[model samples]
Target: SQTIHQWPATLVQPVGSPLSLECTVEGTSNPNLYWYRQAAGRGLQLLFYSVGIGQISSEVPQNLSASRPQDRQFILSSKKLLLSDSGFYLCAWSEFVAGAVNNEQFFGPGTRLTVL
Candidate 1:
């Protein structure tokens, strides 16, 4: 069975501080990984994605950056946190079959960040 894990289920931080969020996938090989964020009352927005190690694509130009150090591990980081950065961060992995474009995404439990 495949499983994804995210650390620090909840976080509260002040402005101008650095932030780091981690996600790791188990029991899968070379799966596509992604990072997403959801505001207090908004839809999920994709932040970053990686098809392979060191191959990342950013969907938005924000203070957040993502990295895939290993085949199944992804990390999201920031140099400074902003009030607008408060949200639920999600990490997801997906598998594509036969080169299909619309693959179903499997999400891990998210990290809720609160900027105070």
Candidate 2:
């Protein structure tokens, strides 16, 4: 029984401020973790991913960064937030599937951030 959790369900920050969002997974080991963002009424955009501890892959060149501090914990951070950074941030985890080409991902409830 794997579970993922995200904190500070909603956030409001001024432009140029720093940001930090946390995610944690329980009941799993070495699972692939992902960070995605979705604008209002738009599709999801993958921001970062991790295959293992200390291994991260960024999918886009943006003002955001992610880190795996522990086996079950992941964090997303930004040194200076931008106006366009306002969106829904999601954290997801998935395990490798033996037969399926792509693993099925399970997502967290998500955190909504508003920049002003």
Candidate 3:
């Protein structure tokens, strides 16, 4: 069975503080990974994604970065946190199928970040 994991179910941090959030998967190999941020009562925003180890793609320009050091490990980091960065961060994984549409993604419980 495949599973996704995220750390620190919730977080409270002051503005300008550094941040590091981790996500990892098990029971899968070379899965497509994604990072998303959802604001209160808003839709999700794709932050980053990776197709394989050492391959990362940023979906939007922001104050954060992502890395895939291992095939099943993804990390999101920032040197300085911003108030606008506060949101529900989600990590998801899906099977990679070439030319496939609507791949179902399994999401982690998510980490709620509150920046003050």
Candidate 4:
């Protein structure tokens, strides 16, 4: 029974402000974590992922960064938010099954950020 949690369901921040978003998982151990962003009507874009604690992989170069301080915790941060940073941020987790063809991920209720 794994569950992922994301905070601050919605946010509105001025441009150039700092940003921090958090995600945590319960009932699982050493699961693969992921961060995704979805703009208005676009598909989910992979942002960052972690295989384990202190291990982060970025899928694309962007104005944001991610960190994993613990096995079940992941954080996304930006020193200065940009106008393009506004979007829906989603956190997901999947079981680490070796050689598996597909790892079904469970996603959290995303946080909608608006930069004005």
Candidate 5:
């Protein structure tokens, strides 16, 4: 079975601080990894995605960046977290099984972040 996880289920950070959140896959290799941010009551905003190691795509222009160093490891980072950066963060993945990409995605429990 494949699974994804994000750390610090809840975080309280200041207006500007370095940020590092990690996401990883356990039973799948070379799966598409996505980093998304959802503002309160708003929809999901794709920050970045990786198809493979060192390959990343940004769906939105903002203060966040992502990287896939290993086939199953991904990381999201920020040099200076913005006050507006406060929101929910999610990491998700689907099986790389051929023809499986057409299926709907399964999401994990989200991480709630509050910044002040």
Candidate 6:
């Protein structure tokens, strides 16, 4: 079975501070990893996705970045946190081995970031 883990279920930071969030998968190899942000009471927005190591696609250009350092480890970073950046951050994964376009996304519980 595959499982995804995200750290710091909740976070509170001041404005203009740096941020880092991590996600990792177990029992899977080369899975497609994604970072998503959900504004309060809003739908999800894709932030970045990585097909492989060092290959990331940014769906939106914001004050954030993503990186895949290993087969199952992904990281999201921001140089400075904006008040607008405060939201629910979710890391998701899908089976890359599956030859399907609409693979089901498995999300972590999520990290609620509160910037004040």
Candidate 6 Cα misplacement greater than 4 A, ranges = none
Q: Write the per-residue lDDT of candidate 5 for residues 7-90, one digit (tens) a residue.
A: 868888887888888887787777888888999869998888877899999998888899898998878888988899999998
Write down the worst ten-residue block by lDDT for model 6.
95-104
Cα lDDT tens digits for candidate 2, 1-116: 88999998999999999999999999988888999999995999999999889999999999999999898899999999999999999999998555667778999999999999
Residue lDDT tens for model 6, 3-109: 99999899999999999999999998899999999997599999999999989999988999999999999999999999999999999998886567788889988
lDDT of 4 by residue, 26-63 (tens): 99899999999999958999999999999999999999
Regions of model 3 farther than 4 Å from truth: none
lDDT of 2 at 78: 98
A best-first ranking of the candidates according to their lDDT comes to 4, 3, 2, 1, 6, 5
TM-score of each candidate structure, all chains considered together: 0.94, 0.94, 0.95, 0.96, 0.90, 0.95
The per-candidate count of clashes, in order, stands at 0, 0, 0, 0, 0, 0
lDDT of 1 by residue, 1-116 (tens): 99999998999999999999999999988899999999876899999999999999999999989999999999999999999999999999998466789978899999999988
Q: Which sections of candidate 1 miss by over 4 Å?
A: 96-98
> Model 5: which ten-residue window has the lowest total lDDT?
99-108
**lDDT agreement with native, every candidate:** 0.93, 0.94, 0.95, 0.96, 0.81, 0.93
lDDT of 3: 0.95
lDDT of 3 by residue, 1-116 (tens): 88899998999999999999999999988899999999995899999999999999999999999999999999999999999999999999999988998989999999999999
Query: Which pairs of residues collide in model 3?
Result: none
